[model samples]
Target: MRLLLVEDDHMIGEAVQELLRAESHAVDWVPDGNQADAALLAQRYDLVLLDLGLPGRDGLQVLRALRARHDRTPVLITTARDAVAQRVQGLDAGADDYLLKPYDLDELLARIRALARRAGGHSDEAYACGEVWLNPVTRQATLRGQPVQLSGREWAVLLPLLARPGAVLSRAQLEDKLYGWGEEISSNAVEVYIHGLRKKLGADVITTVRGLGYMLACQPAP
Candidate 1:
């Protein structure tokens, strides 16, 4: 999904951004609290990966502002080892998840997905649509009992559609959940990934709507 990453360490920031981009997420990376606050105030994003130690406004201040405004956007705080207490404070301040410094990219992405799954607090991690099964935690997909390995972006592309089952997601709507900062997107990148998913998941599984976006052939389990 499109996320705002507020981190200062250029190396870590760049590495994390690249990793998330490889997952096909559109990310907007900003350093310091001012840029982060402005972005939070002026725009909407699927999720926010916030670093607790920030210059100017401080991460807690930013979280407080967001909560005070009842923004309710899902925020995942990045904290340090000694600051375990800050994790609780961050959550209490309105963060949806927490990531300690020196975390695995896999863990970070999983944390992001877990929080986004709570966008409306829909916490079902395993989704089944027809013969397709997706594991958000592992980023694994299986169709008709066959394993499918998806690139990070491809997973980013497919998860939202799977999340909504049969709901139709327009290109722009889906794009909102598919990208991160400094990640290059092809005009047809989404299509390319979707096409690949269709091939692997079976053409009958994903249907296109002419000029519109695609939809998965899934119905929620009762």
Candidate 2:
């Protein structure tokens, strides 16, 4: 998933970026609020990890502007201020979730996954469509409870499609999801990844809509 991290603290931003990247998430880190706004304007992120104590624009103002524009990309506030009122204010200001400073990477990741699931109205972290089941946090893949290993790129493509099932994701969309924007996309990259996914997860898991794109066909078993 693509993430936009808006944080002024250099150390914190670096740590978060490293962690998210290690988890196969593409992240764009910005120090101040203006840069954050610019980044948001440029790209559509799966999530935004925002810090309230930013240098120039301050986090609240950014959140306000985001809400004003009716942008619903999930925002998780990571700030040092831990007062109850401050938390309430941040929530009221449009934060989908809050994370106090001095938190663990695991917790933050859990919240991010939870937010993604909620934003997409998932019933559980273990997302399943037909016989395929995927656990994003654990990187676990299963077919009817039996483990199935998937390549990194395969997981990346499948996760995004699972995040919003039935949505036809074009090749360009999958390219961006597999490799971040501006990265070189080889002509056969998407097809190769899709072929690998089908080989491992079962051919019927992902359906190609002629020229429309790939969709995770959701249906009940007999």
Error of 2 at 163 (Å): 3.4
Report the C-alpha lDDT of model 2 over 30-118, residue by residue, as the tens digit: 99999988888888988999999888898988998998999999999999999999999999999999999989999999999899888
Clashes of each: 13, 0
Candidate 1 per-residue lDDT over residues 1-222, each given as its tens digit: 788889989998899888877777778899899899999988798888899788988988998998899898889888674465767777888888887888888789788877877784577777777777888766778877789887776787787887787788888777677754444557887788888887777777777877788888766545
Q: State which candidate has the highest TM-score.
A: 2
> For candidate 2, what is the TM-score?
0.90
Off by over 4 Å in 2: 181-184, 217-222
Candidate 2 clashes between residue pairs 3 or more apart in a chain or in different chains: none
Off by over 4 Å in 1: 81-85, 104-106, 120-124
